[model samples]
Target: MPTPSTPLGEFDLIGKYFTRPVQRVALGVGDDCALLQPAPGMQLAVSSDMLVEGRHFLSTVAPERLGHKALAVNLSDLAACGARPLAFTLALSMPRVDERFLEGFSRGLFALAEAHGCELAGGDTTQGPLNICITVFGEVPPGQALLRSGARAGDDVYVSGTVGDARLALEAFRGTVALAGDHFEQARVAMEQPQPRVALGLALRGIASSAIDVSDGLLGDLRHILQRSNVGATLEVDRLPRTAVLAAQPLALQRECTLAGGDDYELVFTAAPAQAEAVQAAARQAATPVTRIGRIEAGSVLVLVDAQGQTVADHFGSFDHFKS
Candidate 1:
């Protein structure tokens, strides 16, 4: 129940924009707390992501896209753990309650939630600087959640879809790189509304020994897996998959962005060579194309090598909030 008060008040804003009925949860919005019941023999997978204006995203981005991204990033975490989305909670802070902004934002948010069969349970709203934080709940079968520390020597490394487009778009926006009009729009879409590889993650559940989402740059995120698994990797720099938009850029820029560019919500996973067929079959089932870019090896350092078998020196850096 919402109480009437001043125009665009807190309760009124929630009632008008955020309130919704939930199906998978025991209770949804308008309650003091959201209640959830886990299915038999399944474990809950939860992840949270926060997007701050100017830091995580630009002011020029559309509200709907921001809404989609706010939830998508958190869902990507669930996907990496081979979990199916169950529900989510959104905590939004805005300077004012603008009806038009709320309309677009809610529309984009719920659209993706529905696609994954995730329900909006409950959350809080406040008046402050623009920020969107989403915590997503998912379920994975017991003993089946993919982990980062499971990679083994001789496992093949793979990445889903293309990378670097989002980086290219960001560079374009920063005036550091230039793109043709059509190319700019394509790259912009990649940055604004990255598609989390949820289906592909599910498909790779039993196949991938170690899995992670490429939210940060491929090399950087892959480093996390190597560190966790107590192994290393040799990536073929020329073999990284890139879209036409990124391909049009110079080879130097391509390598720099593909190796260190962040914000692309693709999945990178490793599987044994013997499971190669199963990996391809899973990709086909998920309708997501994956490219093998490297292999796990018996070391603790990541090495980049060219086709000529020479060690490649890359000074490119990946994103870090405090250091970068």
Candidate 2:
């Protein structure tokens, strides 16, 4: 709960900053529990994501962007499951009640929520280390949700949007890589704000056999699908779609970021070869670009090859909370 020093108490803080009336749910905030009524023939899909001050983001990030990202990451999980956003709950903790910060955070948070028709059903606030956790609820038709275990041999692998931009921005912030002003800003936007592919995921429900969001890295997230489906993949290094900023970097850096960079938030999915046309149509319907980067194969190993079919021999690992 927020301290008493500020005019806003815990209940007042929640009412002022987090409460919102919801139509989809029978009961919303100010109640003991939220009552969500899933649409007929639809199953409730829920996902939660946590963002700490230093571990998930730099403290220098804008409060608005942080609010957007805190919820966006959870929404990305809903997207991976081919679900439609319905409502959400936010659990927020901070050292003190900063009215300015809360104003900006709520603005960004509600803006995205409104854009996706996700209502704020309930949440909690407290005085502690800065942490934002959001649990989003969505809906999907029965047995229609995309899973990581459906990929099969001979399926075409695809990824939505360009990759590696977020990593480039992070490297620049760390002073590990230098970038031009325009390039850094462009990459920084990718890092600070990522669009969840909700429409793309919904569109790919029947077309894509398996799908996962590129939160930890392209290869790492893809490996989950591969492992679950008992399949392997052959990636065409040159086929990866990268931003102009990332493309201008050295081959090693480009590969490193594109393969192992976390926080991209793009969708990596697989569909049967016969569904290629349908996949393109789904992309068009969503108005999101999709690229075919590789093909799934028999076995459980992922092979990265250049245009010449030569294996790339560099080790790249994704971001793990415990081991990066």
Candidate 3:
């Protein structure tokens, strides 16, 4: 073979390791620029999110998990919009470089990207507190992107995966929830290494009339759908997804984690009665569990309910950036 070095530099690192795969991009990994050509009759969706140390996450959170979460959260947004993740860019900041940290972080980030067939195109690096920002791009058919505003009265709301695990995991890490051996390890993983529900989101594309991922607490995020769709909702408290560990807590605490605690990143969407079957089938094929938690009504309000269908008092909880 020829000499290994052929003027390859930082750009080469990006192109070789971070570049998007050949599946979706119209262009390759090199050149002065990147060109994208959306598939015929398809619309492109783009989303961006930022996480700062000591703000979005605890400073003590592990670097590998932090890197994974930073990218997963952004991908979650694209999924909610019914988009297939095509590529992404990362912006990382650090006060000082740590080789171990960088290695683990890159491993975590690239692992998810490969699973989803998304590439890390390019991004900027700078000096500062540890902060990771990811911007992702995706594509969906024209006029087919699910949105918060599409829900109508009588549409049923659904959620995928267990809620409150990440929150409970956080609690365990903070020394609040005591666990024995692997239980603690498992919960910590849930809190740190969250998996974005990309497959489920893609599967729900035509099935979900309105969609949003549970980024903010379920209640708060459901409020987003209600406000945008101009509809009211009655969410049954018992119907929400909860892990056994999370449920083992006091009822009030469980409700808090399920309602206001964030980082679930599970897809929450609304479907018409006729679409429920298709929704069920899609989730089954995707191997993700989905639960019907509530229904849409004609107003812009969210009401909580008990198993008896009695209206429960509004908790008004969920992560609010301004408040947090």
Give me the runs in candidate 2 sitting further than 4 Å from their true place: 1-7
Clashing pairs in 3: none
What is the Cα-based lDDT of residue 208 in candidate 1?
A: 97
User: Which segments of model 3 are wrong by more than 4 Å?
Assistant: 1-32
Model number with the top lDDT: 2
Worst 10-residue lDDT window for candidate 3 reads 1-10
Please report, in order, the local distance difference test score of every candidate based on alpha carbons: 0.90, 0.91, 0.81
| Cα RMSD (angstroms) for every candidate in the order listed | 1.8, 1.8, 3.5
What is the C-alpha lDDT profile of model 3 across 1-324, one tens digit per residue?
A: 223545334554454435555555666555555567767888879999999776677877776787788889999998899899888878777775555676677888888888888877667666688888898999998888989999999999999988887777777767877877677776677777878888888888788989999888888898888889989988998889887777778887788888877888998899999998999999998899999999998977788998898987875567877876
Ranking according to lDDT, highest score first: 2, 1, 3
Instruction: Encode model 2's per-residue lDDT on 1-324: one tens digit a residue.
Output: 445565677888798888776778799998788888888889999998999977788988888988888888888899999999999988899898888899889988888888899999988889999999899999999999999999999999999999999899999999999999999999988998899999999999999999999999999999999999999999987889998889999999999889989899999999999999999999999999999999999998899999898998748887899975
Q: Per-residue lDDT for 119-227 in model 1, tens only?
A: 9999999989998989999999988899999999999999999999988999999999989999999999889898888998899988999999988789989999999
Give TM-scores for every candidate, taking all chains together and pairing residue i with residue i.
0.97, 0.97, 0.90
Judge candidate 2 at residue 106 and give its lDDT: 93
1 or 3, greater by lDDT: 1
